[model samples]
Target: MENRPQPFHITLVRHGESVGNAEARWQGQADYPLTDTGRAQARALAERWKNENAKFDLLISSPLIRTKETSEIIAATLNVTVEFDPLWLERDNGDFSGLTAHEVRQNFTHPQFSTPYDPVGGDGEGDWELFLRAGQALQSLLKREPARYLIVSHGGLLNQFMHAVIGVAPQANNSGTRFRFGNTAFAQLMYYPHQHRWAIDRINDHAHWKDTD
Candidate 1:
């Protein structure tokens, strides 16, 4: 058997926590600024990349303020410009936009009205559909760039992207092969063009946050 060629190399980073995160509210499509702790987390991640001599050929992020802020922090240390991409935006929660988790569960009784558990409602794209589009957009972008890159996005989008790359569903406590992205965390992915698949190199790596409180 011949060795298969690897796909493009990419890194996934989740945006730092935001006010909505602290308040346990669904911020889908709602813009929220990063909290003080979130800023610290972003700084810690940036420092980690600098200390480890990490290099990125390109830096991309969701257009959302939180993701843009987080990407800027990392890009500063890398001395690279950041690109804001709408495709990288987080899931659109639609009607669930500003509702708390409890409120969503209480008000929406549909089978798919749960958090990280069920699909969201309203005029939003289905989770599966969003994943498909995001994966396609990423693949197209990788083909154009074809370089080591860093992407700062939301947790929901990250999870879906991981699933698209690894050909699996995103679940809690999955094994190392599974794709899991934490707040201000990162994962390494290599695309295998021969197999037309994206292999997971690492997931939910938070070594950058070691010194953070």
Candidate 2:
């Protein structure tokens, strides 16, 4: 008998715009509600998923209000139940939670203010640390053995997860892939059990936005 590889598909969706997004504020560890435009973006995401005939056995989201709200909208469209998980939560920004980029630069003298991929000072999370967490959380979730899954979270968290999965170096100078994750940006990946590897099918895809426009 030959050993066959088990294949699983994973989709990551960044939550839509939040009040912080509009204000250009850093929304770390803050539970902010989604904007009206954000809700419409989530609906559009669902429509795109439906149009593509996408199906998933599992739906997971961060405990943040914006993510939960976005997940709720998506889950309703896909008829899937959402399992809120703190492991997918955004990195803790500590005192910088509600500060704008300009304010953060003015307040923090740390190099992180200039190069965010380095590490934030105070009680905030380090880029490398968050990368490890994303790796661990993803490993744990895969243990459930779902064939297909959807995850809703913040852009930074999703980027960390991708870095972990792809074994990308967590360095400020890495300047890795040139992909921008706009609001409601979605990515598709596939895991191969035989190779113990994951492949990116899509990244930062936002065709849904164009469709709605």
Candidate 3:
């Protein structure tokens, strides 16, 4: 029998509720701090992971205030340091950044027909661009030695990351599948690089706060 290398373990977590989320604003790389409720959610998630004895060799997060706070809370509870990466930042929305939904309707015109390569908000990365960025991020992670990795990021980027993992192509005109990542929710995945395989263990797992919902 031959020894097999340990599979790469990855946990993808979305930041807790932000003011933008609460206000229905386009957050798209716009910096926003976590609300008090968001902090509480992070604490709850931290407690859940602590109770489960979850361990990770590396914890990376987007440097945005919302993700930074969420990662800090969990890292503190887990006794792990966090490394910030811009690659994990939320999708850049260009002129739509920080704008509310109602404002967007009033300020910008929506095209009835658009392609995946169409820039968002007139200048930001389109679906294809974001997908490519997500691939780059995954590649960077795979370049490192196999180990457990925890990533704290935004929903949009995380969605694209999952798409990359499952080899889902971006669809035109926002018709692609979307992964739901509520506040403090997370997905667990495993990759056997030697076998060139990936497994999605769970998605949108927020059992820690199930009772509250």
Candidate 4:
């Protein structure tokens, strides 16, 4: 066989719906356990991965409870121990945590406060802070090579990670890489150690739940 670099495979999974998701509340960095539907979604995701025979050397999850619960279920099915990484946690909402959209609108002066348009210096987490967290997570993952990693995380972090891996600016308006990851959606990426590059085979795929949903 040719002496080629072994690829580091990463399967990125966004945690299932949380009470905040179902209620349309600002989750920020708050810990919200999975809702009943969210638990069911995790179970289905576990079954889907099991059926596909997806194996991982390491499983990482955000410290947030929603991701923790999702990772626990999937790791149980995969028989892998989970390592909690706060870097994979969701974006910090600062003053907006645990509030509804209407509430946020009532409180914040600017319209972009709740969204990604706000600057990095905003009271809550701006794009730069979130992108830095994703960068830290990616750097940590690079230390482990030639292995499969299954990550259970949040939507914003997933988006930030994808942008980081692809080496693009985190500004959605400028870079035009605004990705939407629905609950329980996933992306598949491979890292070429020799080239120091990442290849995304899939992005924000939730096809497994298409028919079920």
Identify the candidate with maximal TM-score: 3
Please list the residue runs of candidate 1 whose C-alpha ends up more than 4 Å from where it truly belongs after superposition. Answer: 1-7, 112-119, 169-178, 194-197, 210-213
Residue-by-residue lDDT tens digits, candidate 3, 1-213 = 998988999999999989888889999999889989899999999999899999988899999999999999999999987999999999999999999999999989999999989999999999999999999999999988999999999888999999999899899778868998989999999999889999999999988877322
Q: How close is every model to the real structure, measured as TM-score?
A: 0.84, 0.90, 0.97, 0.90
Q: 1-213, model 4: which lDDT tens digit per residue? A: 789978999999989889898888889888889998788888898898889898889999999999999999888888998999888888888878888888877876764324345652247678877888898999998887689999999888888888888888665433467777888988899998898877889876776676322
| Over 4 Å off, model 4 | 111-122, 172-175, 211-213
| Pairs of residues clashing in candidate 2 | none
The C-alpha RMSD in Å for every predicted model, in order, reads 4.3, 2.7, 1.3, 2.7
Clashes of 2: 0
- Residues 1-213, candidate 1, lDDT per residue (tens digit)? 976554577888888888888888898768998988888899998887888898888888899988988888888877977888888888888798878899988987665234333455666756666777678756667666457788898887777777776576444322224355667888888876666766777878888675322
Model 2 C-alpha RMSD to native: 2.7
Q: Using TM-score as the measure, what is the rank order of every candidate, best first?
A: 3, 4, 2, 1
Candidate 2 minimal-lDDT segment of 10 residues? 112-121
Candidate 3 similarity to native, TM-score: 0.97
Model 1 sits at a Cα RMSD from the real structure of 4.3
